[model samples]
Target chain A: MRSVILSITAVLLALLIGAGILLLSGASPIAAYSALVHGAFGDAQAWQRTLEKSTPLVFSGLAVAFAFKAGLFNIGAQGQLLLGAIIAAAVGFGVEGLPAVVHAPLALLAGAAAGAVFAAIAGALKVYTGAHEVITTIMLNYIAINLTDYLANGPWKDTSPGNIVARTPRILDTAALPTWGPVPSGFVLSIVLAAIIYWLLWKTTFGFEIRTVGQNRHAARYAGIRVARTVILTMLISGLFAGLGGAVETQGVVGRYQPGFNVGLGFEGITIALLAKTHPFGVIPAALLVGAMKAGSSQMQFVADVPKEIIDVIQALILFFIAADFLLRRLLRLKAEAGEERLVLSTGWGSGE
Target chain B: MNPWRTLWHYNRGKVLAAAALVVFVVWAYTRDPQIVEAVLASSLRLSIPLILGALCGLIGERSGVINIGIEGQMLLAAFVAFLVNVYTGNLLLATLSGMLVGAVLGFFLAFMSVTLRIDQIIGGTVINMLAFGLTGYFYQVGLVTKGKFAPIPIPGLADIPILGAMFFRNPPLTYLTLLLIFVVQFWLFYTPWGLRTRAVGEHPRAADTVGIDVYKMRYLNVTLAGSLAGLAGAYLTLEAVGSFERAMTNGQGFVALAVMIFGRWNPILAWGAALLFGFATALQTQLQFMNAAQIPASLLWLKQIPHQFIGMLPYLLTIIVLAGVGGRTRPPAAVGQPYVKE
Candidate 1:
């Protein structure tokens, strides 16, 4: 209950800061916020946009949240998502003459597999070489950016008439994700995945092992949990989630593999995961909130002449409040948690020894 | 095992990195002897911001604060410096403003980590996000072109053969970067303050017990480090590139962290690593300009490589370097830990 109250307070404070910024910029906060809400949920198309935007955030958020259970910070979600997206697009376009069911699922699985493999590299490096995953994942993001750019611009360049951009050919109609009213099919899939992830995190033996490792690695080891395997497997699962996000993005939203279309969706995952407090179930509402902000940003800019980056600022502020919960505690005049005032994310460098 | 053999095993990654670089140099030299000097000069120029950024990380990390927010600091400083230069048209004031902004940010990071006990990485991430959003928003509304500082060549030194053109013919900011490398190296290893800073980073409790104010050292070091990143940002706007672009620092700040790891957390070694990264970046650009007809037909495959592939060189090299060498190097024992007062 305290956690929930804290979460609510952090969110309200972030919104307050956003409002303050809006006022300072000479834009009426109420007018701008009303426009934002209306833009995100006013109409059917607005709802669709919100859902579509929320779909990838859900997957990536779950990815990060799930890895956090294993005490791994998967900063490479962007790279992993990109790999998933491009590979899904590849499978979507490269294969021909399959029904929608077979082709779409195939493409999605391929994307998930690619993301898994990409993320597994960092995980394996951490396990085998004692190389910190943070640095490796960050470096890998750059490599992924360049690698995808090369693939798009070189071999996969769309050669259709009047096409000169760095993008892959459109996926076949059979591979497209169908929309059901305001909700995209991929969005529905992400919701299902979230539930499944919650179950995996709380109900199963593997989930127990992961949480154990996260809470106390030495205890996990004493309890006969294979720490390295658990860590690597957790990353693979996290990658799969991020990969599905990319696949859904390709099939549902973009229609083709374009470089810039999926630029910050992965990084936004960090925001979502943190906002959710690394809870699998909590990711849905958190993702929806952020998705609403993203969906409304352009409309806010158009209506209020306020820059869309304000949403980014708000998101950062949200993360800040969450990370520094003591700020909220002080503001609310609440006491700290019973035993410890802070939570551990990951152990410090070289402490694995 | 013999002691010498044990030491060799421990330093195995460094030896492997050296071998890789040697092989790369030999291969590049074999491909085109003339472009080597151009690449070297470009590498030196490109390394200035990287060296400064790495030094920022070095200082902060040495004080037991993980400042992944260096990128944010650089971006914010770059924006401030550009804004100041556009309005005031005073280069020194603009640069100082950038550094000042960076210091303020550093102070906030210190407050979060030292006072509030927030995770350093999370604090840094928040700072990066804020910097990106704020700079990006302002850039859209207020982005403009400003006059850039021109290279002030040192007369006799600039005339010297190859070294002069590469080392001396740079803007004042770049020279300061070069000079600070040695200064930081000497300070980190030789000075009393440096020793105390390292002690705080490695074992804060011990330092505190011995009457060293751990909080003060961390606060001062982090703020100073922020200024270093800020200066790097100022260089981007005032010297390297004259305008502020949204998130213009890109991932160079993160690469600087990799450079910090590559240098084994030593200032001089970090400088060398920064130069190596610069060389990798220059090599990418140089490789793109290689004449297809000049090279042997067998090596013509290089020309077929995509620009994006060439762009991957620096990042890929960074990954390899980290994977191979990161495990071998030791980080400060107390890094990323919030010092709680007893």
Candidate 2:
């Protein structure tokens, strides 16, 4: 509970500093914040957009959070998400004559599968070749971007009259995810899925294997867990969550996978995951907060005369505070737990070879 | 001989990777000779960022600190260089400015990761996030404007041969990169400073006992590496496109990491590995011509094939080579550990 208060205060402190910066920039902090609040919860329309935007953020956050649980930081969620969106789009457009329920699930499943495969490449390489997931994922990200770009530019291009944007055509209407009045149904799905992920991570046998592998591979191995398999599966599951986010973005919000539109969603997931301390359940509120900030940023900019970049600055500060943890440790006067080292990278990032 | 036995006896990863490469080469060759040349040309050009980026990683990681902020540093350097070069018609100034910016970033990272005992991965990730958003916003807003860096024509090198024209005729940064590779190679192997750096990387405790300040050494190496990465970013705008764009580097930083792995973390090996990447990029371009008649127009997936597989090539090859060679090729004893003084 103290930790929660601390986090909220940290976020508020950042907002105040940001508002001070706005004043220095000749903007009214009060006006900016009011506008931000109004814009985010301004009306049904504003709420819809915010929720629409957050639908993907929730899953991406979950993706990063899940990977963090296994002690593997997945910096490639962006690339994996792209793979998911593109492959899902491919399946959506290519497959013919399937019923609505089957078609929607199939496309969604395909996207998740693609993300898993893409993630598995990094995992498999890590297990087989000792390649770091961070590095491999980064490389794969470039490939994913270009591969998707080429596909959008070439065969999958919307070829509709006067459309110059590099993107795929909208999927069959039946394939799109449903929405509830002002709130996107994807947001609800994301909530449900988050619960499932939390259960899978904390309660299941597989979850135990993952946490064990993350904490200490040699010990996990001694305990008869297939360390390599766990590592790969953890990444796969993490990636599937990320891929679902991409699919949601495509079918629910944008109706097409535009390149720059999904730009920072995955990286933002990193920030969200960190702020949540990589808790699967913690990601929901974290996502909503971030989603609101992102959704309300332009409003903050317009009415408050504050630069939208201030939000990013605040986000960066939050990440710095969390990652450095000097402030948190000082404020709480929390004693270091002897065994809590298992929560982070315990055994030096190695094969223990 | 049973294929499975032979495959299993050795590293199946390498065997599979090698087999894939052979298949690709054969497919490339059977298509068209002219296409091959075009692909070669394309690959070489595309490899510019990767080769230089990998060199940055080699220098940083070789010193025992894992610098994941290479991408961020590169982005910052590229943006700053592009802006400065455009404002002033001086290429040298832009390059120097880029190195300076990179060095500052590197110093800060080293201070945090090395001196303060912060987790290197967290430190690197923060740098990446901060750099990405900072640079991206700067570009979006008019804080940094893009422009051209001076292109120089090499005196005799440009006239020497066909290869010289493509390699030497345009930007001075290219030659500087090539020369720096050798400079780095010589420095790593023959110089006393190089030996100490290697020692720190391999066994920092031993080096510390031998009178080297491990923290100081890492700080210097990381700072130098930041500048190198900055230069690579600068090259993207100044040397190649003559402008800076958002995320201009794409993922060359990762490609560099792969190259570092493939190069066995040796400077010379890094250089050779970089050229291999460059060559692979060039080969893909050449294949475009080959597929002109054979592959259907819409099925032009062949053209984008390299896009999907190119970055992986270095990594996949790294896996193959390392698997075949085994982890006999080791990183510094304390590559990722943050040093804290008691």
The lDDT of each candidate is 0.85, 0.74
Q: Give the distance in Å from residue B266's predicted Cα in candidate 1 to where it truly belongs.
A: 0.5
> Candidate 2 — which residues are off by over 4 angstroms?
A2-6, A9-34, A87-103, A159-164, A304-310, A331-333, A337-353, B1-48, B140-157, B166-170, B286-329
In candidate 1, residue B95 scores what lDDT? 93
Query: Judged by lDDT, which candidate is best?
Result: 1
Model 1, range A87-127, lDDT digits (tens) per residue? 99998898999999899999999999998988888888888
TM-score for model 2?
0.84
Q: For residues B159-231, what per-residue lDDT tens digits would candidate 2 score against the true structure?
A: 5434444566555677788788789877877788988988887778888888999888999988988888888
Native contacts kept, each candidate = 0.62, 0.21
TM-score of chain A of each: 0.96, 0.93
How would the docking of model 2 be graded?
A: acceptable
**TM-score of candidate 1 versus the correct structure, residues matched by position:** 0.94
lDDT of 1 at A62: 92
Model 1 per-residue lDDT tens digits across residues B54-172: 99998998999888888899999999999999988899999999999999999999999999888787888899999998887766555565688888889899876556767888888
In model 2, the Cα lDDT at residue B27 comes to: 75
Query: Candidate 2's residue-wise lDDT over A84-164, tens digit each?
Result: 888778777778898878988888899888888888888887787666677667666766777788889887889889999
